[model samples]
Target: MRYACRPVGLLSRSDPISRFDVADVQRFYPRGRPPQPATFDWSFTMNLLGVLPYWQLGPWELGPLTLHSFGLSVAIGVALALSILGSRGQKILGVSGDRMQNFGMWLLIFGWCFSHVFEVVAYQPHIILEDPLVLFKVWGSISSVGGLIGGVIAFLIWRVRNPYEDHIGWSNVAAFTLPIAFFFGRIGCALVHDHPGADATNFVVWEWIRSIFGDSLPEVWPLALQYPDGVPRHDLGFYEAIIFFFLTLFVLYKGRKPQRRGYYLWTLPLLYAPFRFLFDFLRVTPGEAGLHGDTRYLMLTPAQWVAIGMFILGLFLWSKLRNEPLETWKGLEKSTSDDEEPESSSE
Candidate 1:
C-alpha cells in the first residue's frame, strides 16, 4: 500500500512507521526528552467531527505464524478482487472463471514480487547495495505503484501466453476490480498510519473546519497523526482510503452498463494518476537516516514518475480505443458461444 522497509542491521533500528509507539517518542529524542507531549487529548468537537483516535494494531501470533492486520486486509482485498474478476470475466468478457482465477493468481505473484523489487531498487537502492539478498526477500517492502506496474507486466505476459483471449475486455475487468483491492489495501495503510504527510495543522480547509468549532476544536486536526515531536501531520493513507472507497463505488456504477472495451483501462489511469501525483507532494520527505519518509529523485517521488507514465499510457489507450464498439454482456456471451461451436462434419 505504501513504501516501507523493516530495519536492516545497517539502517536505523527504530521500529517501522507502522509499528511506531507513543513510548518510542521518548527514546526517539536525546536524553529521553520528547520535544512535546507524546499523546493528545481529543475534545468533544473533535469527536463530533469524526476525528480518529491514534491507535495501532500490532501483529498477532498463531502457532509459528504471525498475522499482521495490513497483510490480512490485503489478503481480503485480493480475494474480493479475484472473486469479482472471476464472475465478471464470464459475464462480460466471455472468459471462464477458471481462466480468470489463473490469471489473477499470476498477477498476484508477479505483482507481489515486483512490488518488493521496485521498493528495493527504486526507493531504497542503498538497501540492495548493502545486502544483495534483500532483493530476494519479497516480503520486505512494497509500493502501490510498483504493484500497478507489476500488474501491467503480468497482463502482457498473460496476453502473450493466451493470444486468443480478449485482451481489451480483460483489461477492462482488471481496471474495474483493482480499485476494490486498493480500497482495502489503503485501509490497511490507514490502520497503521504509515503514509505520513506534511503538517496539516494550518491547512486552509482544516483551518476553516476548526473555525466552525470555535474554541472547542483541538489544536490538532482529528484526521492528523502526531509525530514523535507531537506535530500533527496528515495521514496520506487515511485520505487515500477515503478516496478509493468513493472510486470503487464510481467504477462499480460504471460497470453496471455496457461500455467500450478499454473504457476503464484508460479512464482509471487518467483519473487516478493526477490525484496520486498530487498526493505524493504531501508525503513526508526523507527524515533522519532516511527514516519515516519516501525517497525522491529530481524533486519527485518514484510514484510521481510512474503516475506520469500512467497518464501517458491512458492518453494513448484513449486515442486508440475511442472508435472501438461498445461491448455488452449478452453480446459477449453470444460471441463466445459462436466461437465454441464445432464446425460441421465433412461428407
Candidate 2:
C-alpha cells in the first residue's frame, strides 16, 4: 500500500516561510533570478521487510489550537527528561524538588527561546534582516545546536546563583538524561521528514544493512525517502533518530555505574560531534536540483560549525576533568552539604 501525505498547520504551504521550507525561496528571491524549487515526493509504499517505515504526521486541531506532532513530542520529551532529572537530583545530590524544578524551568525557557534566535541568526539571517519582529516569534523556527548553547548559558547562570549547589553533579545528571529528550526530538523531525539529504540510492551502507536484515530490509530503506523525481534520498532526521536511539541506551547503561562528575558530559560530545559533522556533508545544498538544503557559512552548515565547537568543548572538558574522582550518590550528597555549611553559618 502507498500513502501520500502533505503537512498541515505550522508546516503547511500556506506559510511560504515556514520552518520546514527554509529552502523554498520563490517568494523572497531577487526578481528574474528565482532558484529552482526543491520539491519531493510525499508518497511512499509500505514494505513489511523494510528496515525503516516512512510516514509523515502533521498537526491536529483542538478547538482553536493546532497541536503539532513535533511540538507535542518536544513537550513529552521535556516532561520526561525533567522528571528523570528531578528524581535523580533528589536521590543523588540531596537536592530539593523545588530547586530542580526551577533549574529545569529556566533551562527550558532559555533553550527554547534561543533556539529560534539561532535559527534565524545562524541558519537564515535574511529572515531577521527582512523583518526584525520575526526574532520574537520563538515558535517560528528552531535549531537543536542553538538549544544546546542556550542550555549551557542557563547552566552558567544557575551555577552563579546557586554556588552552594553541586553543580558538577547536576551536570552529570543532565548529561545522562538529556539524550532521552534528543532521541524523541529527532523522532519528531523524522515524522515530519524536514531534514532532507542528497541522493542515497547507491549508499554502500545499505548493502550491509540489507545483508543483515535479509528479506526484512525494505526495497527502499526507511532511512531514505523517495524524492519527487523518484530517486531515494537520505532523510537526515531519520538517521539522527537511529543514532540517538543507540546513544540513549549506551548512556543509560553506563550511568548505572558510578562515573566521574564530568564523564558523560565531556564524552558524549566527543562521540557525537564527529558523526554530526560528517552527516552535514550528506545534506542537500541550496543550489542542488530538485531539493532545497540548509543554509551554509563558508561552505559549512551552521550545525557543522557547532559540531566543531562541541568537539573542542568536549576535548577541553576531558583535559580539565579527566582526573576527577568517581562520583557516588552518597559522596555527592555529602559534598553538597559541605558546600551549604558555609552559607548556613554566615546566615
Candidate 3:
C-alpha cells in the first residue's frame, strides 16, 4: 500500500515559495466565500516487493507471537484504564463512603477472577493441563459474561456482608468504564485484525478501516496483516464499544448527581442483559451448535441464559426499588446535596 497525503487548500495553493512568504504573513482574508474543499483519497500501494520494509523485532519461534502491535496497544489501554480509575479515586455508586469503596475494590478483584476463570473453563480447558505458562498465556481469551458473573457475585457477597448499607454497586460504574476499555481494545483488534471472525461484506466500516491502514504501509513490509481470507472483522466488539460509550455517558448523566438505592444499578441490567442475550448470537463460541440442532439444555448458551435471568431480576428489583422510601438509600441524600442546583429547578 502507498501512503498519500490529502492536499489542503494552503498546501495546494498555486503561489510559488517566495521571501515574502517567510515572516509576518498574516491577515489575508478573502472577501467572498470559497467553495467547499473536496476530500482526497489518501491511500498506499503494496505488493510482495513493497511488503519487505516492515520487520519483526521478536524471534520467529512463536507462530502467532511475532511482536504483534495489537498486544502492545492493549497493554497501553489497560494502563490508561488503571490510571483513570486511580485519578477518579475509589467511590461506590457516587457515594464516596469507606464501605462503598471497599465494596468497589472487592467487586473489581473478583470480577477479574470470574472473567478469566469462565474463559478457561468454557473454552480452553486443555491449557490448564498442558501449559505450565497457562496463567500468562490465557490472558486474552476471557469471556465478558464471566466477568459480569464475577462482578455480580462480588456485589451479592458484599451486599450480604453489609446488609444495612443501601448504595449502588461500582460494577455498574465499571460496566460503564468497561466499554471505554473495549473501545481501545477494539482499536487494538482493528490494528492487528487478530480477533476470530470471518471477513464480512465489502461495505463494512471496518473494511474501510482495513483499507486505510493497508494504505499506510511502506512499499515493502513484513507486518502481520489480514489476508484476503481470515480478515478478522470483529463487529461484535464494534457494537459493544458503542453500547459502552453510550452507557458511560448515561451513567455520568444519571449517576453523577447520585440517585436512590439501586436506580442506576437496575438501569444497567435492564439495558445490558437483554441486549447482551440477543447479541451473544453474533459471538463465536465453542460448540455453539451440537448434534441435536442447537443445544437447548439451558435453552441458550449458558451466558445467554444468565442474561435472561439478569433481565428478569433487574425488572423485579427496579419495581421493588421504585416504591421504596428514598431516605433508606444513602446515595439519594448525597445526590440531593451534590446536585442542589439541579434539584432546585422544577422536575
Candidate 4:
C-alpha cells in the first residue's frame, strides 16, 4: 500500500536549510532520489458493492506476501474462471472439474504466450525481431487477443486428445467463463494505469459516465498525464471492465438453455470484436509512430482487423454449428430409458 517517500512537512522560512527535505531536494535537483523516486501522489477512490471503482491500492501486503494489482487480478480472475468452468463444465460436458481445470490451465499458459508474442509482433515488431529471445521472458506482459488465440489452439488440441468430449458443449463452457477473466484483467489495467485512453479533448463519451458518477470520481487536471484524476483520459480500462462485466452476465444467461449451443463460440467473438474495435478509438497504444492506439494496421489496429475477421468467422461458424444438440457432451441424441419397453418383434 505504501507508495514512495512520505510527504515532507511544510518547509518553514525560518529554517529553510535545516527544514530542507526530499521534496525540496528534488525540486531543483534532477532525477529525484537515487533508489526509489519520490513519486507518491494522493489518489482519490470510491467503493461500489465491495469493489473499488478507482482505488489505486498499489500493492497488497499480507503477512509475508506482497502482491501487485496486475498479478492479483490475474490470480483472482483465473481462480474464478476455473471454478466456474470446473463446476459448470461438469454439468455441461460430463468432464470432472479437476480435469476441466487442468485443461484450462494449459489453455491459459498457451494463450498467455500467444497473446504476449502477438502484442509484440503487432505493436513493436522491431523490438521483437531484433531480439526474438524476448518471447521467453516470463516477466514480460502479454496482450489478450493473441493469448485467446493460443488458448483456443490449446483447447482444440485437448479436444483431439479427449475424443469423448463434445465440441459445442465445451465451447459454451469456455464462452461462459472467459469474460470473467477479462473482467478482472481490465479492472487490473485500470488500477495499474496500464492502457490509457486516447485524446478525448475533442473526440469523446465520458460525459455520460461522468454525469452519473459526478463527484464520486475525481476530475482530471489537463496535462496531468496520470491516473485517478490526471488528464481526464477516457478511462478506457474501466470502460472495458464494464463491457466484460455485462458480457459475463449475458453469457451466463445464454448458458442456461442455449438454443444454438455451439454458436456460443461464434457469438462471443461477434460480441467482443465490435466492442474492442470501437473502443480502440478511445485508446492510446505506444508504438514506433507514437500513441496511435486507434489504428494499428494501414489505418486500423491489429485488433480492429482481427475484429473484422472475427465478425466474418462468427457468421460462418454460427450457420454451420447452430443446429448442434444441447449437451452434446452427454449425448448427441437422447437414449431410450431401460425401464421403457422395446417394440414388439412384429412390426
Candidate 5:
C-alpha cells in the first residue's frame, strides 16, 4: 500500500480520513515487507479432530459428563482463590517475603475487573437488562482477552510495589501450568461447543480436517457451533490449543530452572497476544475496520483493541524490569539484619 501523510486537520475531519485506502499503498511497498508463510491445510483437521472429546459432552443433556467441566471449573477457581489468599498470608509475615502473595492479590483484583469490563462491553444490552447474577451463570461469555489484560495489570502492580523481588524469576513455570487450565477451559468450550470455531471455507483446510474426523464436521449440530447472541465465534481454538501444546512442552523443558519474581506471570500475556490478534481474523466481529492493518492502526474490534493495548502495556513493563536480577538471598539477609537489632524488654 502506498503510504501518505495527511494534514492533522484533515485527520480530525472524519470524511477526509474516511476516504483513505490501505490497498493504495500496496504497490509502492516493497515485496516481502511482510514475510509469507508456508500454507497448510490442517485448519479443518484441527477443528474437527482437535475437538472430538469436547463434542461427546451433549449440550442439552445434564449428566455425569457435565461433571467433568464443572469439576475443571471448580479446580481452577479453587486453585486461583487459594493462590491469592495463600500468597497474601505469606506476605503478611515479613516486611518483604515471597512476592507471590502480592502477585496473586493483584491478579485477583485486576483479572476480575478486566474480565467483567470486557464481558460488559461485548454484551452490553444483555448485561444492562439482565440481573448481574444471571450474567455470571452464563458460562460461555467471559472474554479471554480481558483475562489477559487483567494478568498484565497484575504484573504492573507487582513491579511498582516490590521491584526488588526479582528472584522468583521468569514466569515460565506458572505459564506452563496455565495452559493445562486453558486446555481444560477449551475442553469446556468445545464440550459446550460454547464458542464455535470459524465457519469452514477452504477446501484444503476442510479436506485435511475431514480425513481425520470422517464426516463429523458436517454432522455437528448448530447448538455446538453457535455463539451467544451479539457475538461471533471463531475457528481459532484449535490453533490456540496447538500453540499452547508447544508452549507447555517448552515450559516442561525449562522446568528445573528457577524463575525471577515477576517473570513467570508476565510471560503469559507476551506469548498470548499475537495469537489473539491473528485469530481475530478467523472470527466474525461487529464492525472491524482496517485503515492500515487489522492490528488496529485505525479501527478494531473491542477484543482486538484490548489485545493491542494490553500487549503494548505488557511489553513496556517487561522491558522496564527485564534487567533486574532476582536475589534469592535477600530474604535471609533481611532476617539476619532484623535479628541483630538490640532487643528491649517492655515493663
Candidate 6:
C-alpha cells in the first residue's frame, strides 16, 4: 500500500534527515504534544505519484486507543489470511470453517509470540533470561524462522487434540498462511524502514521493486534513491516484499489443487533459502549477537544457516512425499461411499 509520512518514533530512533527537520520530526513523532513547527524539509519527502509523501501514517486513534501502522500491517496480514482461508481456501487449508478459525487463532498467537522470541533469542537471549519483562514487549520485532517454529508448535498442539483431521500436518495450513503473512509483514518492515540493505546507491526502493518483476532499472537514478539520512542503500524489506508477494501469488495458484497443498511445506523453503542466503551478502546486520554461522566467518547471518537447514529439510520432505503414498495411511482420501456415511468432518 501507499505510506503516508506519519512518524512512528523519535528522530533519534531513525536517523534524522537533517538538523533543520528535527522540529518537524518531533511534531510527527508518535508521542508528545509538541508545538506546531515549520513544514518538513525536502529530505523527508517521497515522490509516490505526488502523494502526501511522508514515510509513515501513524498511531491512528480510535477514541482513547491508539494503533500503530506496523501493528496495523501485521493485523491486516492475519485478518486477510484468515478471511481468505475461511471463505476461499478451506480446501487448501483442509479444515472446516470452525477448525480453520481455531487453527488460525492459535497460529497467530503462537506464531506472533515465537517470531519475537526467535529474534530475541538469536540476537539477545541474555536479555530474556536476565529480564522477564522481555516477554511482554509486544512492540519488539519478529523473526521469520522463529515464527515458523512457533506456528508449527501451535499446529502440533492443535493436532494432538484434534487428530482425526487429514489436513492437520506440519506442512499444510502453516505453508498456506505463512507467505501471505510474510508478504504483508514485509510491507510493515518497509514502512518502518527496519530492514536496510548494504551500501549501494544504485538500487532505489521503487526502482528495485520494479526490477524484481523483471523491469530494467537505470544505472543510477540520482535523487531517486533516498532514505531518512538522504543516502540511498538497498531496501531489503521492499525486496522481500516483492519476492514474497510473488510467492503468495504462486501459493495461491498452487493451493487450488489438494495434492499441491502438501508440497508447499517443502516448496516455500526451497524458494526462500538460496536466494536469501545470497541476498544477505547485500544486507548488513549485527553478526556478533547471533550464532557462529552468523557471527564468525565473515559475517554470515544465522538466517543463512537456517536457510541451508531448510534446504536440506525441504529435500528430505520432498523425497519422503515422493517415495511414500498417502493411500497407505488409513482414511487419508475418503471414498464417495464414505461421504454418504454420517461422520464428523474431523473424523
Top of the candidates by TM-score: 1
Model 4 residue 156 CA deviation in Å:
2.8
lDDT of 6 by residue, 196-283 (tens): 6554544455457546633333334332225555455556677788789999999788755555335677788889878778766756
lDDT of 5 at 134: 48
Cα displacement (angstroms), candidate 1, residue 226, comes to 3.5
Candidate 3's residue-wise lDDT over 1-347, tens digit each? Answer: 11112233232333443555322132232334332333433332233322111112222346665655556655665665555444333443345545444554676568767787776665566667886455454355666677778877887887777776443444444444554555566555545433333223332443465566765433322232333333422344445556766766776676465455556557778987876776555444444222111123354666677788889888988887776443233345465677886766756
> For every candidate structure, what is the RMSD over all alpha carbons to the true structure, in angstroms?
17.2, 19.0, 11.4, 16.7, 18.5, 16.6
* Candidate with best lDDT: 1
Candidate 6: misplaced stretches above 4 Å? 1-54, 61-63, 92-94, 126-132, 136-139, 167-170, 202-217, 221-225, 287-298, 323-347
What's the ranking of the predictions by TM-score, best on top?
1, 2, 4, 6, 3, 5
Q: List, residue by residue over 134-229, the lDDT tens digit for candidate 5.
A: 445534346666665666567676667767753234232234456555654554555444334444334244467566756645433222233343
Give the per-residue lDDT digits (tens) of candidate 1, residues 195-263: 878876677766787688565675556677765556677788888898899889988898888888789
C-alpha TM-scores of all predictions: 0.77, 0.75, 0.53, 0.69, 0.51, 0.66
Clashes of each: 0, 4, 15, 7, 26, 5
Clashes of 3: 15
> Of 1 and 5, which scores higher on TM-score?
1
lDDT of 6 at 181: 80
Against the reference, the lDDT scores of all candidates come to: 0.80, 0.78, 0.52, 0.68, 0.49, 0.63
For model 2, residues 59-110, the per-residue Cα lDDT tens digits are 8999999998988887888888888888777767777766776778788899
Regions more than 4 Å wrong, model 5: 1-54, 58-106, 125-140, 152-177, 203-234, 259-262, 265-267, 285-299, 326-347
Candidate 1 residue-wise lDDT at 88? 87
Q: Which stretches of candidate 4 lie over 4 Å from their true place?
A: 1-55, 62-65, 204-230, 285-295, 328-347
Per-residue error at 230 for model 6, in Å? 2.5
In model 3, which regions exceed 4 Å deviation? 1-102, 126-140, 167-194, 202-234, 256-258, 285-300, 325-347
